[model samples]
Target: MTATSDGTPKVAIILGTRPEIIKCAPLIKACDRRGVDCLLIHTGQHYSEDLDQVFFDQLELPTPDYNLEVGSRSHGEQTGRMLEGIENLLEAHTPDIVLVQGDTNSVLAGALAGAKSNIDVGHVEAGLRSFDREMPEETNRVVTDHVSDYLFAPTEETKRYLERESVPGEIVVTGNTIVDSLYEYRDLAAEKSDVLNELNVAEDDFYLLTAHRAENVDTRDSFDRLLEGVSRFAAQTDREVVYPIHPRAQSRLDEFGLAVPEEIRTIEPLDFLDFLRLESAAALVFTDSGGVQEETCILGTPCVTLRYSTERPETAYVGANCLAGLDPDDIVEAGTMMLGKCADWDVPFGDGRAAERILDVLAVGAEPDAAEVPT
Candidate 1:
């Protein structure tokens, strides 16, 4: 109903979390450059100014066209709220396509809302699987991929998974958009982020950590073990571990009366640029975030993934990362092993043009001559 005057398709880009913001930024920028008509919608899954608003400011992304303010709640309640709000939006300003990136409650709700409303939905970073149904993210990823009209798979490995599942979407291997954002912002991060001096840490002399997954941090035993492992690793390596704690993780630590070891320094959440600068320079990065795994691998930094299984197996296969499930001994061993290895692994993501490719596909679908996308 809200088509552009020239029949240029209007796309509604929906996101709710910090990771989604980071991944979708390149596509948003591409839309602006190509004169593609698009509107951004914030689901407000992450409402903290530190976690949400700072990303837009640091990335120079435009303010969202709509903000549902559907703050945190039980998964069912949160998804239900988002579904209701998104359905209303779709009915009111029916866009030609609804675009969502990454696996989250927001992704699932957006895909379902679009599908139910009879509107096309495009899923970015589709077909990634840890194959662990217990992980909520895995469910979100699987459900979103199936409901999407366009599946922008990041690799042949991911494409194979979709093929095996026989998803109905038109599958395109457009590589990962993270590559585009990283390539675009690395130099800017170097020039602008003074995080190193502020933290008083030297490049390649410290370890970086991020463990905020519910499976890891929601339980006391698991959270305590994770901290113990990282503490042990830091002591053995004689290097400080910088942990920019997530709000949820911080809350759990307080509730459980837990503490990080002396060698591990906990700090406030960082904007994308500062975090990118630290990730790029850190000697080793430890995390349970799939995004961090991809980032550290792309930056040629050795990574220790803090989970039993990873959706990003390419990182492990390419010698860029090792999985050390929450055991202290395992974490120390993995850290020691990775510390001895070289950081010259081949990048498996893409050529830094995924956003352009995605927009091109959408443009052709909208109208043959919608806009001329750059090669």
Candidate 2:
């Protein structure tokens, strides 16, 4: 790892999942352009090379300088291990600042470790709230934002959320780096990927489905309901339902004795580029993932969120998304409604310059120390 120097400070970029890899690509490039020495660190929360390698290759992201290999575990265990690993790394590298994106446990771990080390921490996609504390992501975001020295919110709503909390960090509404990445790579995705052809799915010929939340997968009833919903939708619409299954979801499906239907194709998880192509061509998208919710809105694809709520409610408010709680009937109804509707809604996320704005915020000096206050 590179050390901080007088000319240019060393910046540590931390990521653990495919979403993080995609969202951080633009910011990594932005830092490179500014002559910042970037150290990419992978926490290995999601450890499949098949699932993660494509993103690095597709995004042209640098191989991580270090990989903690902190594989699957309970939420507490994973977070605890990541915290220890990241703190040790921060101590060795002595980066001027740490950059973490989104609301993963990895984000929280990186932020806390950096803050404890007295290194400034910058959080991209900060200040998002679903107002549901049961979700681990909500807790992760709350803790990460509190410790963050720089908070890069994607929307004005997010900035307001931070302001309401009286967060001391500099808050800049940088649009969304995901949008920047999507628009930057969409053309390339279209040209390079054979996902459409392989799936026998022509433009607007199929509905996309992705459900991988632990709440939904950890329960047999919930898993069965999700499968039933997809089966019903496929039978009724005669349109293909393509699900690029997360490994955990696939395991749950088997455990529940649920079979993915013939019309409902269950494929391995796709890389970032392939997934983007599928998202752009789909008639409608059904998912529980925050990243998919944001991307579907940007692609102008109507979405039916399989969860009761989403942190990215801006998509729902803009008519690009509808929350259909994990019920077979609701899923079918929402998918039907979306299939018949015209996709003309505007994207609520900003135009693709989020990375530039985020880096600009990070370039500013750190927040004031509480001890510096005068009596």
Candidate 3:
């Protein structure tokens, strides 16, 4: 493992997607203060400079020391490429421990590479389970959690899930890092952006829509149903639906000859700050994202999840989120209900000091006993 001039251990932070970058930012800064040499590595899974470069600048995260340039590809192809690239980087850098966050393929690849190299792997935002075998992300989470030496769960529920599964690691309940990052960046965005003024969005004038799941986008029927539902809903209501079109979703929209309705404003994927401003000022949020569910819950903004199930069910448990599958009618009904609902909901996620708790656990240097593998 690489050592500092005075022989301190080096910590390598691995990130690839936009979410990973944001979630890892606070921890990276924390490591910096402790005199630990931090090396940031980007797997380049989502390699858009516009979507990525601005986040690093906004979040004040250090630019990656290594970029693998793995970019967008088939699931197997991307994972294979990242695994090989990460293994090579581990050989070269030899960090004391490799840190990966969330349930991304990049995280699984990093963990597998670290385990194969006999280096310690620390997983942040770990022990989350959707219990749905159909979703690839669920598989990734399970694999990464099993391989990881440290499992940093975001809630007691997540920790309990790990305990039931007999996971061989120290599962610490550190709360959600996204909440910490969200509150920090939200304050900054409110001060810097005149987003509310520019958009002419009052506290509850419009609704935000974000849908880019593979299950929803892979089929023409599902995509059409979503568009039709939004179109019908917008026609019935006076409010506008602002959709920040994902690149993959945009391509599908064009290929399917689907027009973005006049009432639906299709904009590019927003940076963290702009997104926070939009979500905060919206009357309601409709998404298929787990992160968005938690974010909207913390903001006390009602949300309609466009998927059948969510990894973050705490939002629903707290009466803040509604699961409105891909059916257009259900989507509209859920959105309408959220719009009229009172904004007094409890934050199921803990108070936003998850990063500090996670670092505290890591600092203790408590390693789990290695378990024997069943043949």
Candidate 4:
């Protein structure tokens, strides 16, 4: 780590996607509050309005110290480019510890770069598995976990997975940072967002749909099937389906010649606050994103996951989520079932203080002194 003449430890938080920015916000703030020299790196993995720039503005996060601008490419091409860019950056500005989050290709690249450099690496939100190797995210999560030196798992279940896989690290059971963000932003969403008024949709009268997972969107058949399900559900329920189209999803829609129905009004991707308000306002949510599943559970909103499997089985076990793969009939049935079921379960995630716990471990290692955490 390049030390300031005063000698405080230097840390690097590497992130490349919009979700990473959102999840990493509290940790960044903690660093600033505690006087840590934390460097932010944006690999530009998901660079667009909703996916990128708006998050920084709405979340009030500082602009990244470096933007690799390594926009979309094939998986091999994107990861290889990121690995090269991050390695070069690390050589120029060495850090004591490298922290990465979730299972994006960016996370994989960041972890690989740090390990290869012999830097101590911390993997946040570690040990999640869908058991589906076909899902690139599963591969990313598995590979990153193995190489990390500090594994900050979100739950006991995840910790067990790491144990089974024989991952070496101080696997601290810090709750998920997404819980921290949900608590941090939900109030802000209520206070500042006018999404409901702007969309002309009443609370609990719409279905919030977000399908941007590569597994769901990259293929012609799967993409067509998902859209058909959304259309079918809308036709059956006569409920307006609000889809804030992910840039990636929009491209696939055009490429595959699939059409969104009149009932499913597609809008530009929303800023974080706006999206949170919409999530609470919706009667039910249909999504393929892991982050959304956790968000839905925290918001006490019923959700129909548009994937056959989820890394977040806790949500399903708690009666807040239903798994419905890309099949149109299954999607419609699951959405219908979710609409009828009320989210009566308690929050199974965390106590909304995970960011503080995670930052404690990052700042002070496995046994964070109580004094290091604020009251």
Candidate 5:
């Protein structure tokens, strides 16, 4: 690996979705602190101003160096476009290392491009498995982990998954960077966001819902069941459910001609600060998002996941979340179970220095901080 003219490592950070931006914010900032020559590349998988630009503004990240606007498309086409665009950038810029976060198609493309170019690839939040091959994200993450030169697993359990696969990468148990992002921004969100007032909701008086995965929202049966179940739970509790609906999920609702219940309040998607504020204050959260599972757990908020399985089972293992598969009865039961339980469960993610540790390994091949590594 070669260093830049300044004798510092050069890193190309590739991301496309909201979760990736939020999770990678810390690493981006860490590069600045460490004087690493960093380049931000966006694959434009999520190209909307609402889904994409707002996150960069609210998170205080610099504008991306390049935006390959490969917007919505079939899975194969999207991944293929990303691969072409990322490979061209890799050849021209020739960074020493490529870093990708989570299990998005952009991540898969970044890893493939970096490996094909003979540049080291570092996979952050690696070694997650839902064990169900039906999910597209499962395939993306599995392939990325194998191609990566550095696998930064978020927990011992996640690291174990990599070991079991015998992936030819150096595996280090660096806790998830989402923890770092949350710890860094939670106080900022609380101070700067008045989303509760803006939405006319009170703390601990509303439920939050976010469902956008294809398996959960694309099918009529699955999507209908999810909305009905969460609506029923909200009605029984006499609390309104706030949904900052993702564009894809909203389009599905329109296509399927589904009517949202009166108890559910649908709103435009929020920026990170506002969403963090709502997540911190909501009575309970319902979602099919993996990042939200980790966030809600870290915030001590109860989550009823709207999926049959999750890659982040650590949240469920610690009693911070429950899988409510797509059944109205099951969803309501899961809500009741979580509502009855206290929100004092121990956070199992990390101590919030994951980005620093990941950069340590990538920049200088240092050992992970022993104190912060989750057992």
Candidate 6:
């Protein structure tokens, strides 16, 4: 890895999704503390200014050095555009390492472009696989991990996944950065956010809902099923299903001419802190969001994943989450079952120091050396 004038490695952190921004926040702050030369690049995968810019402002992250603004497109078009844009930026900036997180088209393109540029790529939250080749993110994570030079696995389980696949990169089991963000921002949310008051809901009285996975949202039938489930559950239980609708999901709903039932309260996307407060206080949550799976686990809140499969099996294994695809009956059943269970459980993520450990690996050129967990 090439070092800058002051000897610290130059890292270009790339992310395109709102969840990616939240996950990368701790690492960005860590770089600031170490005086490492870092550049944040937003791929503009989620183009809504409210969703994208609000996170940067809320989390106090430096504005992205570059935003491809490649907005949503077919997988081929999006990846191709990102490949071109990221390649240009990497060549011009000449960063020592390109860091990307999670399974997104942006992550895949960034890793590919960086490796092609002969710059080592560090993939945070790497080695996750749902074993379902049909899922776009499964392919993204698989491709990204294979090409990356530094594979920062969130858990030993994911490390095993990479090992089973025989990936070439050095695997360092740094706990999920989501745990760090949750711990840091949960308190901050309580201090700065009045989300609950604005929504007119008290702690533990409502079920926080989020559903924006392409599989569930893009498919007309699946999207309808999710709404039906939420509506049914809310009508039966007399509890509000607080849904902070994603822009993409809303667009799909409009296209399908589907309406969220009066029982399911819909609102705009919440900033990172506000969302954290909402998640922490919810009696249970229903969503297909991967980050939420990890966050709810750390918060000791129950979650009912609205997808067929999940990359984060650790949450299910710890009994903090239940998977109930797009089937309305199944969704209601899983939500009811989870709500009936206890909230307190062992958090399998980390001690909120993942960012520090990640920087430790980068400091030594991502060579596996020492840690509480390394797989």
Give the count of colliding residue pairs in each prediction: 0, 0, 0, 0, 0, 0
User: Least accurate stretch of 10 residues (summed lDDT) in model 1?
Assistant: 366-375
Distance (Å) between predicted and true CA of 359, model 1?
A: 1.4
| TM-score for each of the candidates | 0.95, 0.94, 0.93, 0.94, 0.97, 0.95
Query: RMSD, each candidate, Å?
Result: 2.8, 5.3, 4.9, 2.8, 1.8, 2.3
Q: With candidate 2 superimposed using the best TM-score fit, by how many Å does residue 124's alpha carbon deviate from the native?
A: 0.5
Residue lDDT tens for model 5, 1-375: 677666767899999988999999999988877677888999999988555787999888999999999999999999999999999999999899999999999999999999999999999999999999999999999999999999999998999999999999999988889998999899999999999999999999999999999998898889999999999999999999999998899999999999998999999999899999999999999999999999999998999999989999999999999999999999999999998468878878788888888887765433334254565
Q: Tens-digit lDDT track for model 2 on 188-258? A: 98999999988777998898999899998889988888878877987898888899998899888878877
Q: How accurate locally is residue 25 in candidate 1, as Cα lDDT from 0 to 100? A: 95
Tell me the tens digit of each residue's lDDT in model 1 across 259-341: 77899999999989999999999999999999999999898899999999999998899999999999989999999989846
Worst 10 residues of 4 by lDDT: 366-375
Order the candidate numbers by lDDT, best to worst. 5, 1, 6, 4, 2, 3
Of the two candidates 4 and 6, the one with more favorable lDDT, higher being better, is 6
Local distance difference test, per candidate?
0.90, 0.85, 0.82, 0.86, 0.91, 0.88
Once fitted onto the true fold, the runs of candidate 5 whose alpha carbons sit more than 4 angstroms away are: 364-372
lDDT of 4 by residue, 1-375 (tens): 344456776788999988899999877877776778888999999866345778988888888999998898999999999999999988888888889999998999999999999898999899999999999999999999999999988877888899999988788887888888889889989989998999899998899999998889999999888988988998899899999998889999999888787878899988889999999889999999999999999998999999988999989999999999999999888887889687789776667667668667665323234332221
Q: By TM-score, how accurate is candidate 6?
A: 0.95
How close to the true structure is residue 106 of candidate 1, measured as C-alpha lDDT? 97
| Worst ten in a row by lDDT for model 3 | 366-375
